[model samples]
Target chain A: MLLFLLAAAVAVAASLAVVLGRNPMHSVLLLIVSFAALAALYIGLDAPFAAVVQIIIYAGAIMVLFLFVVMLLNAHREDEGTGGAALGGRPLAAGAALAIVLAAELAWAVLRTRRAGGSWMGAGPESDGTALQSVRTLGGVLYSEYSLAFEVTSLLIIVAMVGAVVLARRES
Target chain B: MSSVSTIGQALNGIVPVMCVTLAGIACMLAEAFRRRGERMPIGGLGLVGLAGAGASAVLLWGRRAGCLGVAEADDFGLFVQLVLVGIGVLTIVFSSDAVEREGLPAGEYYALTMFALAGMMLMAVATDLLVIFLALEVFSLALYAMTGLRRRVYASAEGAFKYFILGGFSSAFFLYGVAFAFGLSGSTHLDRLAAHVQAHAPAGGLLLLVAMGLLLAGFAFKVAAVPFHMWTPDAYESAPTVVTGFMSTAVKAAAFAAFIRVFLHALGPLRADWLPVVWVLAICTMILGSVVGVVQVNLKRMLAYSSIAHGGYLLVALASGDEVGRAAILFYLVVYAVTNVGAFAVIALLDSREAPMQTLDDYRGLWHRSPFMSGMLAVFLLSLGGFPPFAGFVAKWYVFTAAVRADQYALAIVGVLTSVVSVFFYLRIIVMMYMTDKAAEAAPAALPRVPKPAAAALWLSVAALLYLGVLPTRVVEIAARAVASVL
Candidate 1:
């Protein structure tokens, strides 16, 4: 319980910092910290495979790409003149109101589930006897049960590749 | 041995999609090996593939096959697949001239079209949300590229960028909804989701509603229902006219197919919950589409709004949630696809490199230049306005009847009123074509000659529409049977 609370707090704080940071580089680094906190939460939920993937794929690889883009674009700190002032009027107020309403509704749902003696969190793989977190089991399921989707994903990738070539290639 | 047999069975359900995918691959190979300045009939390859897909889809009818528990080859899917194949064949036929005239990359154009057709076919048959999402992305990516095929045109690039960004947001929303569905039911298959809904009726209340709302929003974006329709006009106007036709017709047909299957078949027990929401959407879409369409001077934007209105009519049919409504959707899709594609083909034929004729003013005195083309456009526009003796009238009639049958009297009334209001814009275009004359000094060079293939395709579309409008009973019966298989 203590670990869950600690990881959740870290995640919340880091996510807020990522959004609120002035500098693009600081934002990217804060996002990595937020991703690490999410991995820790995944570990607390007994999903070691998910936690490791969260760390490797999101925190390590995607964040590096984000950093590269930031540097390449030469992005700087948010301009004080346009940063908050641009969204300072009615749109901002409406956006905040909508966000608050959405958050409250989500909180109510979680509380309702808890009050009804239902776990808001998902069941661990041990309860299902499937070892779902293991890469081998995931592969087995992907091949056997969801094989059509797996194959279709290959088609999707081919289309993306073709599209990239079509859009990015220099015309002769 | 059992696994091998299972694989063979799974393959049987997807032969049509495979044919198109293979054709796409072949087109790519041919492009790579082509001489620098050689002209290839790559579009012919697409037609051959579509023919094979049509044949396979016909064979799969009544078989009731399942592919790896994710896609099903029911008569409903086969019917939509036949429509998609027809759309693909016509698009390829019409694109041949447009490709050369506009200097488009012919190989990439036909290949991307085939891939998009394949994705559309998969979406029609997919029974699993995950497969549906993948299929959606496959086609959307291909279309975004196709929209920007005119690399030198700033408008094309801008449209593609807007569509891609908005499309990504919708896909994320859809995936989030799928996640919520999985979390609630522990499965992504429609049958399993239906079973879960049945087992936990009142228990899955708020979360279930959220899932449905999110899914509906995703579909509404794809179908261009009002309030989520900001992307349609710009995207439609900026794309090559033929592409605009394909997007308006085939994409809507595939998306509607999945929407019907997921909502009417899977979450059917909660019809009462979603009916009111769809009801409101239908009304708003009808009103906004018709009203905004009146002020547009650009023909493409006008037709874009018209297509959104047509989507509204389809949503009215969907909200009915009855057998008649389901069958009406199939019949309406067939008629609308033929008529809309014909109209866009005319616009494409009139367009040239030096004078890309698109605005309402450009269409003025078109009858004096080419009587046949103007007459064809008149017919298509009249049909779109739901005139009798044309396919669109019958389609709208059936849709409104479905609403009336479901006791949605207000929806039917609004539908009828909007059809009347929307006819004004269609007639305005017709007036520009025949009634008004181009000023002596303002007349441009002589119009380009209509190519034989495109003219033939237009004739086919017109004939089909007249036949369906006059004698809709046979097709209506077929549509009924198709809906019966799934619903």
Candidate 2:
């Protein structure tokens, strides 16, 4: 648990460093670290399926696309002018908002935990066997109790597919 | 696995989407198989597919709720789906000429459009957070690609890049919010979340608020509200005019549909906590969107700002959070969609080539060049400006009245003030059209003939605007019932 917390903190700091870093490529690498950390957090939350999916889809696929595009576009921070530092002033505003959010989250966590009295019961002990079993159960519930969502998910994939094609078509 | 038992139920929910997916595939095949010398099958198959989707949406209306693992279907989802499908049809009709002019492959354009429409329908009808996220990506990725469709134009490429980056960032925030909600409530279903929020009440505190706020920020960006609106102008201006038309209408509607669903259903009990945040968003969107529009020389950029204002007005209805408020949103969406599309169609016709004639100066002496087209543009613009005896005014009236009825009188006042402020920009174009003299060669060198199908869309939009504006009672009654049934 201590290792996980430390890793998560390191990941968040790396991500901030990436955003604040002067080099775009360095920032990209930092974002990858952030995504990796998020995946770990998802795993620790007992949603290994989501964690793996996040790594594959977001970290592996989407970020690669972003990198390819950024490199192909050959964008340089120098070309963009150091307009980013001025954005730092806005950071104070962002920090205030973040503080409020953190306060609210802390309060909710305390209250909900107090209300539940630390009940860590899973939905059912019978399904507490394996990650595979959890995935199977998730799929089962997704289709049986949540099939409408499944269909919508399929539709979403279709839209993304088409969106890619349409948006990428060559000009006449 | 629960696969076998739910297959039947799943198939039931899948048919409508399947029809579109199959049609898109068929269009691709036809495009590939066609003879080299022959014209591509542009209008027929794509139109038919969208038409079929629309028909199926109606056919499946009220059949049963919760066929598979989905939450359920109801009047609200059905109504929103109908609106989305209708906008899809309109977009295709309006784009027929514009696409051809730009030398875009009709097959890819039509397929993506159908796919995006399918995603939107899914989004409007979805009750699951996971499904919503997927649907968002489906449509957004499609839009991002479409924004960069004109690849040689560096501007389009830049705009697409911006949209993709920001869109991806927002999606991440949205996913984190969903994760928090699932962590807190143990289920991502709207009904379940509502129950949890109600049970927990004020004590649910920061976690729930964070979840809701993150979600709000995500939707605010999608809907192009003030602070999150940096991407709208550039993306809209750079994308093909037809793509912009579709994005502004169909995409905006889908986003708002999901927005209202989440707020009204999942987060209702925590209204007091989030209401102030939304109130500020509403005011900023209205003020900035309207005031900023006045300075835009580029017509597309101007319309982009106006869209932000429209989003603000919709926010007012959402913040009001009443049956009437909900109904007002639905009605306003329909009217706004029609009027905005009509305006864009006119803009598309006013320009000759892929190069945009969007500057305010270019519109001078438009009245003398094409009387009918200019007049049509006037009607649509007037409606958008909230001018009376036109649909825009009536839609505004309904939304403001709904706000007042909900005891959100201050919001109503702000809305009205913004509407009046917005008129200046809308009239700026009208005055340029009618009052100014045609500067030598100020008008477009040549006006393309308004194709019959495109004309039909414009006429329909104008007729709907006037019809709904004059007699909103029937539509309002229907909208009210639709919203009430969902709640």
Best by DockQ: 1
Chain A structural similarity (TM-score) per candidate? 0.60, 0.59
TM-scores for every candidate against the unseen true structure: 0.84, 0.79
Per-residue lDDT, model 2, residue B230, is: 94
The per-prediction i-RMS, to one decimal, reads 0.7, 3.0
Stretches of candidate 1 off by over 4 Å are A1-133, B1-3, B202-204
- Candidate 2: TM-score of chain A is 0.59
Residues B351-418 of candidate 2 have per-residue lDDT tens digits of 76633467888788888878988899999999999987887888888788878988888889988988
- Candidate 1 C-alpha error for residue B441, in Å: 1.8
- The best candidate by TM-score is 1
Looking at candidate 1 chain B, the ten consecutive residues that score lowest on lDDT are B438-447
Could you tell me how far off, in angstroms, the CA of residue B480 lies in candidate 2 after the best superposition? 0.5
Clash total of candidate 2? 15
Worst 10 residues of 2 chain B by lDDT: B64-73
| Model 2 ranges with Cα > 4 A deviation | A1-135, A138-172, B1-15, B35-37, B354-356, B442-444
